[model samples]
Target: MSSNKNKYCLFVVVIGFLTTNSAYAQNYKKLDSILKTANNEIYSNPDNVIKIGEKVVKQAENNVDYKIKGYKLISDGYSAKRNYEKSLEYLIKSSQLLNLSKDKLLKINIINKTGIQYHQLKVYDKAIQYLDQAEELIAEYPYKDSVHTELGKNYLVRGFIYKEKLSCAIAITYLDRGIVELMKVKDVANSSSKISIAVYNKGNCYLLMKNNKLALENFKKAATIAREINAKSLEAFALKGSAKVLFLEGNYKEALEALNKALSLSVGVNDLILNQEIYRGLAENYLALSQWSQFEIYQLKFLETQKLIKDTERTSVSESLGVKEAELKAKKIELSNKFYYLLLILILILILIVLFFYVLVKRKTNEIKIIKDKIYLLQNQKVKEL
Candidate 1:
């Protein structure tokens, strides 16, 4: 009866263990699906991305990978909203987890993303530092597809950095390199947006260089690719770029037409930068055509958008300071916990060592006592024999 009861208990324990493992597997799978959805909607529905990412982060528990991914997704959402400071905060959280993870690819991705955030913040040197780290890791990473993809992104950001620095000639080189790297991937659909971005940026560089012919060609190509992918914001930016070239070439009517189309497409995109550029472009074209009233309206709209951008930037900076303070507090608490844990482990080891010595000493004493007893007995027996 006892044996049967023991077997039953063992069976129950095994079943419980398997059930726990299965539950964990299911939870992780669900989180993966949620993350995929968040990524898919990151551009069009940034708020949804943040919401889904927060859910994943809350549910990740002790899963390092999922937690990091959730943080990254949140960062991406903030980036899409043009809240670079908030985006950097989440990315820093992801970076803090790197020590707990053995996944090099994850490290590479997080570092790259951090660099991109810095670039958006106009911290060019810091951005390059992080990108350099990612590039070094990519060199050692064995997966060809992932390496190519990440490298392509790295080059793209580099191009943007140079472009922002007003080095259009150097920027074009990096953008061209990025395009080539991105095209090396087998899944063209997955990389279409990135490729289009590279091409668009290249067009911008040519426009800055006053090479209208090449600029128009690249913008047209980028717009076609953006249309195919249904990337409305990209298409709008491309159209806006086309309008700029047309305006510079003394084609006011055509520029106005392109700007109107870009404006139509940008309605729901929430891309403030693109909207500002479009408005400014429209105003320029109207002024060129001697339409004072139309030009005044768009010029006012452009200034309003510009003011809105400044306000958003100020808010981001304020929130970033708050996030920094919170992170500092968190770090202090984590350090305190680690210190206590270390002290506890040291105390346990000391106690274990003391107990081990006590056991050894007690056994030695017992053996000595037994030997002494035998000696006394032998002496008594010999005396009796005498």
Candidate 2:
């Protein structure tokens, strides 16, 4: 009867264990699905993305992978909203977990994203450092579709950096490589958006090179892809690029029309950067057409927008400094913990060494005593015999 009861209890425990594991698996799947949804809404509805990310962060609890992912999603959402400080804060949070994560791919992604954030902040050197780290990791990473996509993004950001530096020739090479890498990954999430961005950036580079024809062609292609992908902000930027090309070609009316279309799209997407660019384009077109009143109106709007951007940038810079301080504090604490851990290990080794030596000496001493006793016994026998 006792044996039967023991078997029954064992069966119940096994069933409970299986049930718990099954539920844990389901929970992770649900969280993954939620994160995917957040990713999809990152561009169009960034506020919604932030909310979903917060939910994921709370639900993930002590799961390192999921928490990092949640922080990344929040960072992306803030980036989309042009809140670089908040974005950097979340990215720093994700980076802090790198030591705790064994996922190489996750590490590469977080490093790459941190680089991109620096790029947005115009911290070119820091951006390059992070991108270089990501490149090293990618080189070590096994070949996979996702790796190709990440490599493409890395190249694309590098291209953007060069473009900002006015090295159009070098930028074009990197942008082309990025496009090729992205094309290698079929059906990858956000690949289309990334491709559009690469193409658009390429157009900007061409414009900088004074190659209006090539710039127009690239801009049109980028706009087509962006529209197909429903990436409204990218489409707006592409249109703005086209308008700039038209303006350079002395087609003021056509430029104005393109700028108007871009403004519509930008307003719909609520992209402040695009709005500022469009307003400036409108002002330029009106000035070229000798429409003084219209030019004045748009110029005022452009100035206001520029001021707003500057104000936001200033605030973001202040907040970013705070985040940096916090990160330094975290690093100091981690280093202190590591130092103490090393000290503990050294102390343990010293104790072990002392114990080992003591045992060896004691064993040798016992052997010597035994020899002395044996020698004394032999001498006593000799004396008795004598």
Candidate 3:
């Protein structure tokens, strides 16, 4: 019983910290500010994040909009801190706060964020659906740079999914399209961060398709771009991708140096995805050198990272399945509507035919009556003459 009480208390703490106290922005705008601060501190200091998150939550419990935003903020903070499960929880909560919004854009943002969470979970189908919805929403939006970035991400993610499935040709096509579209976007449409991600994906496509020289070139270009924008995390990612190419080509010595730098830069950022890549590179390099111990260590790390990735993917795919189901439902509705419209048109034509025949019959009846009256008058005139 005491254990149960403790569990309940913990749940309350989690819930309370993730909601706003008022429904309107007026009463709970402070929560947003507080959440923003908490999110900022989460990567730099998890303890401070929890502190500010708690403060924000305590202040905004009943505010639906604030609660929704708060949940998303907390999710981001947890994700930055590498607490994947916690992040997923808050993002899911944020997703359920639909009643708080009438703005299509905010809803879209939430969907996009949840889609990202699904991607992290490795649930590709769900990620695709959310991303697709986000794209549809973007098409209807007045204008925004973030939407373009989201679409670019959707394409890039799709490319990654295809690459993972070993459909290198399809992956490259999508990545190339994504790159072109992202470049053409203007006026807050360009996100250097988003651009770098797409370029990295493009390089992956090249590598997977066995265009090693092009892959090497794109990776180098992306790394330079990352450095220019102060994105150490992505710079490491580009290095890691390049090193993997070298490792596959039996260039263990060079791959080893590249992997070392990649790992060094990535670990500080808690970039699990990159960490996984570096480990795989190390495993291949160690195998090349015939170092059993180093090879085993790297293999273990890679396997662990792979399992985490697979889990993330599964979550994304589950969400995507729901989206697929929703899409199927919508299509069915459209077909039903079309059928009804066709039926109504046929009925309308039948009504017109019936009305036309009725009018013709009435006119003929009146003409017959006039003819009979004339005949009766002529007969009376003949009788008078007789």
Candidate 4:
């Protein structure tokens, strides 16, 4: 009977162990689901994206990958909303978590993304810093196509940064290296587009150096590749480069035609950067043609558009911050509830341990008492016999 009772108690313990662990597994699955959902909707529904990210972050404990992924999701959402400060906060968290991961490629990719974000915020030096770090890391990697492609992007962005600083010679060198690397990427779709961008930037660098012949050649090559790949944005950008060359050559009529075509393409793609460039191109073309009224109109339009873009970005950032405060408060409460649940589980395990010990001690005591009774009866029998 005692043996049967012990077996039943052991079975209960096993069941409790499985139940507790199963709950933990289910909780982790839920957190993963929330993270995936947030990723899919990050740009389309930025507010909900952050809310889901916060949920995953709060629920995740001691899981490095989950925490890092959650932080990334939140950062991406903030970035899409133009909340660069908040986005940088979460990106920093993600980078810190990289210490817990063993994947070198993921680390490099995150570093690259950080560089791009800094570039968008116009922190040009910091952008170069991170991109430089990515390049250094990728150097140790074997010469795979993917690695080459990433290196191309790093060099391309760095070249643009140099261009902004008006170091045309240095920019051209970087752009040349970028184009070379991209050309090594085995004819993939992404590689094709990157090659177009790299070459286009190279053309701009050449233009800055007053080398119109080479600039025109590179721009035409970029446009041909962009058209073949159906990358309309890049095509528009390449066309603008060509138009700039035409403007510098004093072909105002031809420059106006190319600029008009690029303007329509830029508007169709809704690329604000390209649109700004188009407006500037039109303003310059008109100025060169001695059309003062047209020049003035386009120049004013460019300034107005620039202001509008800034205003829209600021409004998005402000709105995201307002939404985030409320969501963060809710997440804190949810995290508290999770802590309580963990505490409850610990208490239950402690109770189970105490019950196990009590049962063990009581069983030993009963056995000892039975042995003592046997000794007493044996002594009485011996005395009676004597």
> Which one wins on lDDT?
2
When 1 and 3 are scored with lDDT, the better candidate is: 1
lDDT of 1: 0.88
C-alpha-based local distance difference test score of model 2: 0.89
- Lowest summed lDDT across 10 adjacent residues in model 3 is found at 39-48
lDDT for 267 (candidate 3)? 55
State the number of backbone clashes in model 3.
22
Clashes of each: 0, 0, 22, 0
Q: What is the C-alpha lDDT of each candidate?
A: 0.88, 0.89, 0.73, 0.80
Point out the worst 10-residue segment of candidate 4 by lDDT.
36-45
Q: Which candidate is the best by TM-score?
A: 2
- Model 1, residue pairs in steric clash: none
Which candidate, 2 or 4, would have the higher TM-score against the true structure?
2
lDDT by residue for model 3 over 252-276, one digit each (tens)? 8998988898787775576567788
TM-scores of the models, in the order given: 0.77, 0.80, 0.61, 0.57
- Alpha carbon deviation, residue 296, candidate 4 (Å): 5.3
The sequence of per-residue lDDT tens digits that candidate 2 reaches over residues 114-196 is: 88998988878878999999999999998676698789989999999998885889999999999999999876456778888
- Give residue 363's error in model 1 in angstroms: 48
Off by over 4 Å in 3: 1-66, 77-84, 144-146, 162-166, 180-190, 271-273, 290-386
